[model samples]
Target: YVAPNDSFSRGVKYRIDTDKMEIEQLWQYGKERGKEFYSPYICNVTYYNEGHYLTHSGGIAYDSEGNASTELGPFAKLEDPNTVLKSITVETVNDEVALELEVNSNFYRANKFTLYAKEEGMSDLELGQGQLLGTLGETNQMDTEIPAEETGEIVSDWHEAHLTEEVDMLTFQAKFEPGTLAMLVLEGEEETRQYFISTSKGLRGAMCTGTFLPEDDRDTRTVVTKDGLDGEYKVKLIVNDKKFETGLSIRA
Candidate 1:
């Protein structure tokens, strides 16, 4: 057991030695010399089927009417992890920009990919076809070579029909700026799809895409670019569509 008020305490570890058991106190910084410590006090203890335990205290609350309540416990709930696009790099060469995306999910497979650019002031409901810069087929190679100025880690070992494959890379020529929104639509086998949009990276002329979404009732999501034109735009992954809708922004 660990004391809640003991800031120096790290945790507790138990060792079973035949018929004898030893309890060791773990500290963040080894052990203190001639220092006093508080005893472990029970607050709120929770147990899990996985043989794990969590203890928390002082999280309860009461209203004016004397009704007591407490926040959700640590093991109360769980959510599915979001699919991530990692190590995304955007580069500018000559007059064209290149995009490199690596899917971090081992279960989701992406085959077809498309990109669209929209103006800042456009209405959320009006997710026009924007500009269908281009699309990459089932292959992992791009038609045009990505110039050295815009090249990052290469995607290799892409096998057809394999769920866990290499990156999907594509390039296009377009002029975008701060407040401009860019959307990436990725299609996979059997209607498995994902969407992402550009967002501000809190830097001047240095934006990158992430998983940010706009608050609109429509199935479409949007994000505005931060201040940067370094070919990098922030984007947010919105939803995982299993129907593979044709429209740019529609209900999943």
Candidate 2:
């Protein structure tokens, strides 16, 4: 059996020969000097050439108490309002650091391509919008029926709410106190859709990507697609016991 030191994120470089089907290890950047290079989830080393490579040490995380944590940064952040997420992207040549950037969010991997490489797709992208392929995952819904307990008051200044509408979806943005129970209710003449908005931080069994992780853990953003619905709906939010209209309406 083989095991790492379990302290820092791990990085390794290998030499693979296609003709002979041979593989060789060039270096491993697990425990190096006084610095740390560890990314357990989605990161990679891009070989520019011999002795030059770009390493992405994404997924570095710490708990609310400022202790190093083994849990994935993005997932842990989702589960706890105070958990921190960070990514270290370094470009090293001959074991010498030419560039290093630290971001306050987790990433799948750093980009290996040069900026505007081949003017790739930029020309085409300007011409039209790309359509999302396949179906989106099911939107979480609250089945328990609760008629609007409309409170004439607006959500408190702390939430800092904003509702942005696109052609096919509405992105609801706000901040919530950790452990606070909340729900988003959309009432339209065609039909009504209700969703439970979770502000309570809790861990999940698995995580695919952390691209959508917000910089601030308290930031709550939910994308409610307008598909399969028609007409305009009054957007409202239920915090604790009372539901209040947002003074905004969106048409699907």
Q: List lDDT for all candidates, in order.
A: 0.25, 0.73
TM-score of each: 0.16, 0.55
- lDDT for 44 in candidate 1 is 29
| Candidate 2 TM-score, C-alpha based | 0.55
Lowest lDDT 10-residue stretch of candidate 1: 71-80
**Tens-digit per-residue lDDT, 113-156, candidate 2:** 65454665664435467887765545667879666567888777
Residue 104, model 2: Cα distance from true site in angstroms: 8.3
Query: What is the lDDT, from 0 to 100, of the residue 141 in candidate 1?
Result: 23
Query: lDDT value for candidate 1?
Result: 0.25
How many steric clashes does model 1 contain? 17
Tens-digit lDDT track of model 1 for 1-252: 332223221122344565556554321111230111111121222332222333222122222232221211111111112221222122223213233233321111122223444767543556456554544433222233222221222212220011111123332212223343333333333332222333334432311211222222122322222111123222112212211122222221
